[model samples]
Target: MTQAATSDTNVLDLSTCDSEPIRTPGSIQPHGFALSLAEDLTVLQASENLAQHIGSAAAGAVGLPLARVIGDTAAALVVTELAATRVLERPLYLGTVCISETCYFDVLAHRYDGVLMLEFESVERRASADFRNLYPLVGEFLLKLNNTVSTDAMSALAADEIRAVTGYGRVMVYHFDHDGHGHVIAESLADGYHSYLGQRFPASDIPRQARELYTLNRIRLIHDANYTPARLVPAINPVTGAPNDLSFAALRSVSPIHLQYMRNMKTLASMSVSLIVKGKLWGLISCHNETPSPVAFERRTACEQLGQILALSIESREDASELQFRLDLRRIMVSMLGGLTQGADFIDNMTSVFPALLTFARASGVAIVVDDRLLTYGDTPSDEQIRELVGWLSIRAHGDVFHTDQLAAGYPGGADITRNASGILALPISRIHKHYLIWFRPEVIHTIDWAGNPHAKEGAGPLDQLTPRTSFSSWRETITGTSIPWHKGELELALEFRTALLGIALERAEQMAELAEELGRANKELEAFSYSVSHDLRAPLRHIVGFSDLLLESASNEDLEKRHRFLKNIKESARLAGKLVDDLLSFSQMGRAALRPSTISMNDLVHGCIEKLAGDTHGRDLRWEVEDLPEVRADASFIQLAVYNLLSNAVKFTSQKESAIIRIRAERHPHENVFHIEDNGAGFNMDYVHKLFGVFQRLHRMEDFQGTGIGLANVRRIVERHGGKAWASSVAGQGATFSFSIPKELPV
Candidate 1:
């Protein structure tokens, strides 16, 4: 055959091997012959070796009913069996049929690409084996498989069991890892047979098309690698005008390169059974022989059954293991939530669960970042590196989590921290705050034992065809700059953790929002206070000017009593104006003051404020009702000022009463302390209550209640500074109650 004999018409090289069209090689192994027939049993194409296998008439059978070549009885069996099968791309046995007086063959039929492929293998070659005798072998394998526990153990058991059934020189269980690289996990070898037990094979060893074929055809056998391929009479199918899809044909010839690969390995025959788990080709059970060996179809069927059973076992074990791993992650997530709800800041709570966090995703390190604050645990990169990573994460991770096992491939800066952080799983705790919780995995440096140096390739073959590697010795490859790839389960757990972290972060963010609002309110009040101060101060200055001008006018006509009265009035007004100026300065200072909280007895604090006001209340008929007050955590000086303002206002407002009554008490709730001051005074109307807490906002006439309105504003500011609140409730003529609340736990 010339190079033009292959449909691809390209020399097999590293660049074109993947597209080699191994499925449509247009030939069959010389041990068995294949025929491409139309739907009505017309022979569209026949193998060239039909004359060697059957007779000269069979060799020229194309464009004729298959009954004309193989006798009517044999062709009828193929037609009847295919008529009963519904699913396509799977071979159905037609049993043994005699094409002539001496030509007896076992036939298999399958449909693909609108054509029926019928493959024939000589039954005389089998000494005695058939399907009826293979059941006990299957039953015995099942009984021992129940004793196996781990995946490795089961793989070893399968390799041993398959070798015993097939009598292969070497049988290996090759498992594919997450990276699509295969490694020999278990092996059974005969005497003088080489072992590939611990070696790895790159994914390129089997090109993409070959793996696809394995998925469609679960078992493939090459009886003799050195046999010349018997070419089909018509290279392309007449119906499709393309190469017939021989994907399901048992006798389909494999790629010449693969045949060369086997020759280089010093093997004459090979068979492979695919291990498909959950509808995906997971690995293979590879068998090789040192001589031209052929197993009966019955034994091959038994091996196929074993492969199915092995696939199921592997799926069950992997599912069970993943389930347990997810359950473990759930427990760690529960512990993390417990810590987060302890009323500390997000960083502190996350740090408290650092050990569990590391174990949560099998991470080597973890980092919690909120705003500009960063906290790290276990093995970690430098602070600068983490911050840089956070900056990058902030752009992509809006509300979802992001993860990558090959961090350096996606993030250039990651190359510098391969030792500490080759993999990263980052969850955005709060996008608003630029907050994140990240887990890190360090680079795992290990060596791979390849069957040969994968990169080593020799010059082209005699006809410019790429040759297979000559050596099959173990070659060690030391890999670097990559961590163990994160599995689907781990990525799922990270998303779950993200959901939980968002909840805690949202709660903390709400508190921050409240603080922001308070600051905004303070700013507005400051602006209003500035406007009201100038207006109120101008009135006092106007009164001083009016009295001094009147005194000056009366100076020329000075009666002694008028002169004395003017002087007294002038001096009293000057003192009142000075007092208002001092109060305004104090109010300004209170707004800017920082809170220094300590434990204080509300009872003692209230008593101190009342005693300070005793001089003004000494001559009045005043009654003081003091209820027991609770101890609170607050700044002593600030609380005292607030309490003084409330008590002093109570005293002045009720001075009109013949019998003045004042009450002070406190109440404690689960989260805050509420204090109230009630007075039986000439209370103001509730219509204008909103103005009660504004700076210099007076609800009553100045002549009726002679006091600055700055007191309540000052009280509100002091209370808010400690993350508390203050308010008042009143009736038109009865009395008023002033109240304030302070949180049990302060904000940081």
Candidate 2:
């Protein structure tokens, strides 16, 4: 083969190279003949070697119907298949067609660029016999594959099987990584042959265009790397006036640069089958022969099937492993939730679960942020570095989870932090506050063994051909500032953990809200109680002093009835002052008391309160209507006190009525039970309802009610403390109803 020369001005520039034009090269390998036809099956162009296989010369076949050039049977078969579909990546084999009395050719038809392209190769009568014997071997190979456990084992078994089936000098399983670079993971070689296992190749060696073709065709064969490419007679299709697309052609001529690459490696023949896993190209099964060894279509089809089976097996094993990993992580999360429930602080709970997070994510370190506080565990960057990382992420991360293995490449300041933590998986627990839970992977300093020095050549190759590297020796290079990449399972686990962390944040917010509400109520109650105590004590003291002075002035000379009246007035005032003090102390005690809840009948509690209020109802005409109430979980003593206060107020306020009616009933709710006390009493105005529950907040004068105004206040305090609410509805001159609801269950 003559090498094409390149002028100095037109030397190949790697930076400006485009691989798209390679798809339609308008040429075929000389090993077979190709013919392109119009829509009416008229032969437009034929390969130069068409005369060798058929009775017609390439120039003479032009403008002739394809049926006359090949045969009526072959052309009819091609038309039948093409009529059903025009786009076919896989060719339709039309069997043997007799072009002449002594010559029979195997035909393949495919549609490309609106043109029907047919390829012909000479076939012997005994060709089917060789393929028939290969089926039993294929079945046995598949059975052996079923027993392989891991991906590596499967790769090794597949390589050995392909080598045995093809009789190739070497067979290698080349696996591509996330970055598109490939490494020889498994290999089967002849004795004394060089091994390519554990050797890496750069992504540019295959290029994006070649990878795309591999995905589409699935298998490619090069019978003779040194053979001259056979040109089409017209070079371009007559209908479209464009180069024919040979992307799916079995005998499509390869790029000259690739041929030079194979020649430099001393490879005479080569074949490759793409390994597609879950619709993506995973890798390739590459076979190289030292002599010109052409693989029959039947054998290559078998290789493609084997690759498909291997891909399915790899996907199954990977899915199973990931499932088990997720199950284990979920178990760990359950334990972490338990720990969080027992801990007093959110940050402390996260710190306690840090080890579990690291294990779940397979990370080296972890950082948790609750509000403005931050906590880190294991091998992590300095506090300052972590703060910077958090700040950087706060601005860029848009979702609940963000992860990257090459953090330094994305954020320049991360390079400083990469010494201890290169990869970061961040989960924002609170987006508003920028609170996050971050997992980190330590920088991994490792060496890569390349098949050849990737940096050996510069942009000095010929324009028509890319220079191939001369060496195949292993070249070692050190790499840094990158961690082991995060897998899909790790990202999923991070998102799951973020969900749990968010739950914790929500729970904390709820607790804070309840606490703030309780504190506000307590402050208001304290102020009311203070004012009530001061006024009640001072009024009684003034009464006692005034009556005692009157008694002292009357002495022995004054009338006995007047002295008796003064003494009696002083005694009554002192008693009233003492009772006021007792009531104040009781209300204060209710506020300070702890809750000890248990299952109790609301009916029994209400009945007990009625019995205690019987003394107050003795002089009054009372009618009681109490309904059956359900059982509840609450502090029994506190509930008793609350019921007593309500009953006492109902009885005292109704004393002025000729016939007072008290109705006590309970209504069931989804999460709580509500009890109501309806009383025909001296109902206060609705406008003063807000003040009805405050200590010393009285609508009626003391002379009319004849009691200190602490009963309703105590009732509100006790009910609220029990995780329930108290409210009242009333209108002046009408009956009033007081209702309170308690939860069905109490928290421990």
Candidate 3:
């Protein structure tokens, strides 16, 4: 009953076996018969051996109504049972029905793609396990399953339980790794059975299409691998106009290549129940037998249920394990960060916390890059190699965290460091500072025992070129240059640590920036102080020397009036020099003095400043305008000096005016209070405003304005020390206004 060779497979290459259409094989196992029917119960196609199961009357069943082939009673029962089952793709069992006087078959029906598929299995083939036997087996398995502690324990329990129920020679719980290769994790074998408990299988062993089919059809069985496959009567269904999609069919004939695979393993019958966890095919509960063994549908159903429970147990345990790992990482991070905060040097802090840092992500070695310096712990690459790897990572990275199990594959420069750093997990703490935290894992060399040499193949045939490997002996392979992969919890915890470390790095960077700015300002102030000392202080001293010399010469000539005038001139020059020194001392003290803020009336402060400068305005006809000023909290003495400087400048500059007009006012704001003093004076050009507040900076000539240029600079320093600023605006020769602001809530 084998399918005749077709032109489609004439050039089939052994390499392209994965593309073989296994689901549309247009055949069924000899143990059962299948029917493809239309919506109206018309038989579109039937198995060629239908007569063996039913009678000669139903042999040519194609193009006939289901009632004409299997009789009205059986067809009516199928329609009635299917009517009660609302879902599609899952077959519903319709209790055993007698087709002939001695022929009793268990019927199953399901619908897919507008076609209803009916399958019949003869009850005489296998003695059906009654509920009395099925219940105790399932209940015991569930009870023990709940008691199992780990995935391996659960898998072992499942293999034993499934073998107990199905009477298979051996059962193995196969588990797939992240790379798709499978290995047996647990096994239950009968006496004298050869074990494959530790053997691995390549991903190609079960081709991609076959794995996809396993997901859709959770349970599949080959009653007898050596039995002939019963081809469909018409080969193609009239409704689909092609081979029927038997993905969800119970008795669908599998690929010939797979049948050959089973024979190579010396297994005449096999069954597989997919372990579908979280909607993905995680693994399989594979069973094999040396002799022909057909499992009843009821026993197969129990195995499927057992597989589901096993998948759930594995998922739950994996979740619990991940949670525990994350909690452990968190504990390690807390201790490590605590150590970090104890030291100011980043490298020193990391060095002290190195042990917990390694334990944080289960890394074998660690590298901390700070301020362009590389520090290593335990097994790691050389400093030069690490720097090169970091450089490459900086260019290839798309995010703050990057990880790979095969660093040599990911980074070309890492090839030389495979023994020490085959894998790396890099987290950039601060890209601006070139700060990075990298963890390394050394190469893990191990040998793998594959079920067979996956590379070996037999010579190709013309029609069916693909051949399953004949040998099932153990084939050893040595793996190198790769480390155990980083788990999801490990990567996730690394990201969390990166976020926290970035915060600390950014804060440190900001503090450094502020320190640099302060240093620059201090340097500028030192330069200005030097200039004032060399020029401003020297001028007054020279004047006193010249005046004293003149007085001494006039005394010898008996010119008492000239001598007295010279003495007065020398005395005045000395007083001016002393005043300049006093101003400089006050300016210097402003920065060192701590703020002593108290509530004060701005009105009284302004009036006091005006009164102090009354000496300069005594001879002039002056007019004053005062406004009600807001109250502020500030250092009273400093505010007074600042006000006095502004008022004195306003009066001295307006000395030539016939009527000097001065105005004082204050502006209130939510955050601070601003005050202004306006005067009709000989105002300087606006272009030179930037020099108004600088030490020894002046706009007018020395003879025209009789004072040192330290007055405005002192004003700026005093106000600034009180968390305020002083500035002025003026139009040339028209008037000038000086303003300062004091924050209501001054900085401590």
TM-score result, candidate 1: 0.68
What are the per-residue Cα lDDT tens digits for candidate 3 across 468-502? 67777889999899988998888887888787776
Question: Model 1 over residues 176-268: C-alpha lDDT tens digits?
Answer: 877678999999999999999989887878888888889889999999999989888888888889987788888888887888889889999
Using all chains and alpha carbons, the TM-scores for the candidates as numbered come to: 0.68, 0.85, 0.76
TM-score result, candidate 3: 0.76
Going through the candidates in the order shown, the clash numbers are 0, 0, 0
Candidate 2's TM-score reads: 0.85
Candidate 1 lowest-lDDT run of ten: 1-10
Query: Which candidate should be chosen as best, given TM-score against the real structure?
Result: 2
lDDT agreement with native, every candidate: 0.84, 0.81, 0.83
lDDT of 1 at 34: 76
Error at 438, model 1, angstroms: 2.8
Worst 10 residues of 3 by lDDT: 1-10
Q: Could you arrange the candidates by lDDT from highest to lowest?
A: 1, 3, 2
Error at 595, model 2, angstroms? 6.0
